[model samples]
Target: MNTTNNIVPAQVIALKKQRVILKTETNEVITVNVSKGKKKDKVFMLTMADLLRSGLWIPVNRTLRQLMRYDWLDTPVKSYAF
Candidate 1:
């Protein structure tokens, strides 16, 4: 079985302290941690590992495009282009 096929597409709806809220294409909402660290630090972008662990997947192309639109997110679009 291909695990990738089970991955669901979701959009970042809101950002909270060390957490990211996402709404799926099917209208399901999910909350995921931004970092695995202990400190209460700020996070700019979500990592591929974090998304996968949270059962979410945002395509690289869409991530790059959205990165531009969500300027508050710190990081170059090229980083997600991969």
Candidate 2:
């Protein structure tokens, strides 16, 4: 398997009702998760930190480009490895 990565720019926006959204230039809303025990910003930042630490954060540009050349979309959510 080939493992490569890239980064692209995106805008992180907060919505009402404690929801966090990631909006791309193309107006794509990638993921939306609600804030649980912390502030919206804190939750979003920590979630991003986890994603980055686990190598699951992929920029939207790279995501779309890779979709054309790759057979599978990159997984940004942690998956069970056991």
Candidate 3:
């Protein structure tokens, strides 16, 4: 039940009642809750939704801002702390 540590490729299936259902490569599915907010916030949410839909998951410790800064999504994680 602890799926947080599981590394699985997931794809978005549908959205209902503000939740996203992700179907993994193994056929396992998980639903993630999404928040409804203003248009500004929706931009960020949509980006996250796209990532999930593409079967990519971001680590909890990293922020979207950091990812945007280094283009790590298309590359690899680089240490920016120095």
Candidate 4:
């Protein structure tokens, strides 16, 4: 996996079953898969924390920020073993 520390501002454009489509400041559209845990098990939605940890994208617009905030509040805590 190619991971980077650089994060770019983006706007959430669409939400799929286990993916999120975002439009970046440069007008680039990207589809990201939502997952969690060390194994990267798939999930149904995206969260701000997820985007941050991804190190690739960040929600920039007001609506997306609100949604990400809601997602952060609603997410359940889980323990992962290394």
Off by over 4 Å in 4: 1-6, 36-82
Model 1 worst lDDT window (10 residues): 60-69
Across 1-82, the per-residue lDDT of candidate 4 in tens digits comes to 3223134467666666555677777886766655545125334243433654464545443332222433434456663234
TM-score (C-alpha, index-matched) for candidate 2: 0.31
Error of 1 at 3 (Å): 2.4
Write down the TM-score of every candidate.
0.43, 0.31, 0.44, 0.40
Per-residue lDDT value at 78 in model 2:
59
Which of candidates 1 and 2 reaches a greater lDDT?
A: 1
lDDT of 3 by residue, 41-80 (tens): 6655576667656756543211111222235444333644
C-alpha lDDT of candidate 3 relative to the true structure: 0.50
How accurate locally is residue 78 in candidate 4, as Cα lDDT from 0 to 100? 68
Q: Model 2 over residues 1-82: C-alpha lDDT tens digits?
A: 3334334444545344554345556666654444465444564457554544554434443443321212123243455354
* Backbone clash pairs in model 3 (N, Cα, C under 3 Å; residues 3+ apart or in different chains), count: 0
RMSD of each: 10.0, 10.3, 8.0, 10.7
Q: Candidate 4: what lDDT?
A: 0.50
lDDT of 1 by residue, 1-82 (tens): 5545345567667666666667668776666554555224323344433554666446322222222224323456777755
